[model samples]
Target: MTIQVGDRIPSATLNVLKDGVQAITTDEIFNGRKVVLFSVPGAFTPTCSAKHLPGYVEKFGAFKDKGVEVACMAVNDAFVMKAWAKDQNVPEDLMMLADGNANLARALGLEMDATAFGMGLRSKRFALYADDGVVKALQVEAPGEFKVSSADAMLESLA
Candidate 1:
């Protein structure tokens, strides 16, 4: 079953590129903060590149305007995520997390078999609001869909 609202976030190590690759734990990322964590199936895919990520980038300031921290994750390596962040010209405050081994996906029971696409284990597109590591809201998109997981939708949930 998928992780539900009110569940304490499962512990996992995700990576980010700073100077070199650095491992960041769920505790470090989510503890004592209201976080908006959004996941994509892969990095650099058209929709993910042109839309999913940019939506978050465009709204990063607005998210902070409401006192929320924002981060985006994918099954790519820290290197790829870093490159994508630069390519997307994302701001320094909008973190890019790398679930290099799908650890977070497995922990959340959000793993998907994308073997047919040669992507292997990938995270279904989703977004959630968490307060000091406890989930407040989660919006997971249906397979092949992208409705409720947008930043606008996430911001709406806060209202």
Candidate 2:
């Protein structure tokens, strides 16, 4: 089953590009923090590049003001995620995380098989409000839909 509100984040390594090197961990990122974590199907995909990520990028400052640290995750490698973040003009404030191995996605039970699309394992689109690593709110989109769980909707929930 998919993860839900009040669920504790599974401890798994995630690739985070830092200072020209890759840092791997699950502890420092979410532990003891108020985090807004969102996942997309793939890196540089149409809707994700165009809308999903941009929405978070645009509202990152507001989210910070509300004491939420923002993170975007995809099943791509650290290099691709870092490059895509630059292409998307993702500011320094928002973290672009690489779930290259899909460990985190699988742990959360949000892994989706896209081998038919020539993409291997990937994450379903979703967002969560997590406080100290425990989810407070969770939103998972219906397949191929983007109506809810948007940054705006999550922000409104925080209000």
Candidate 3:
């Protein structure tokens, strides 16, 4: 079933390029921390690169100010995520999570089929707020739409 408010984030490993491709666990990320984890369909895709990721990059500080750690997730490999991070000039603390196998997406029941677009299994464009591993809010966008999951919307939700 789709993860809902009050659900604990499931345990799963995700890749991040720091020093090398490091496997980090969901527990390590969400435990003891208030986090806003946002997912994009794929890294470097038009909407993801142009708007989705950029919004988070731009408002990262605001989240930090609110004591919320922000993470950007995509169903792409670690190398691609690292390259995209470099291209976007993402901040040091803004985590780039690589869900290469769509594990987290499946675990959350948020997987979307993008094979028609030439992209295989992917996660839907969504954002969830969690406090110490338990979800407090979630915003999922409709296909071909971007609204509720934007960084601005998340920031406003915190207000």
Provide the TM-score for each candidate, comma-separated.
Answer: 0.98, 0.96, 0.98
List the candidate 2 regions with Cα displacement exceeding 4 Å.
none
lDDT, model 3, position 149 = 98
Tell me the tens digit of each residue's lDDT in model 1 across 1-159.
Answer: 799999999999999999899999999999999999999999999879989999999989999999999999999999999999999999999989999999999999988999998899999999999999999999999999988999999999998
Q: Give Cα distance to truth, residue 77, candidate 2, Å.
A: 0.2
By summed lDDT, the worst window of 10 consecutive residues in model 2 runs over 18-27
Q: lDDT per residue, candidate 2, 28-50, as tens digits?
A: 88898999999999989998988
Worst ten in a row by lDDT for model 1: 42-51
- Pick the lDDT winner: 3
At residue 107, give the lDDT of candidate 3.
97
Against the hidden true structure, what lDDT does model 3 obtain? Answer: 0.95
lDDT of each: 0.95, 0.90, 0.95
Q: State the TM-score for model 1.
A: 0.98
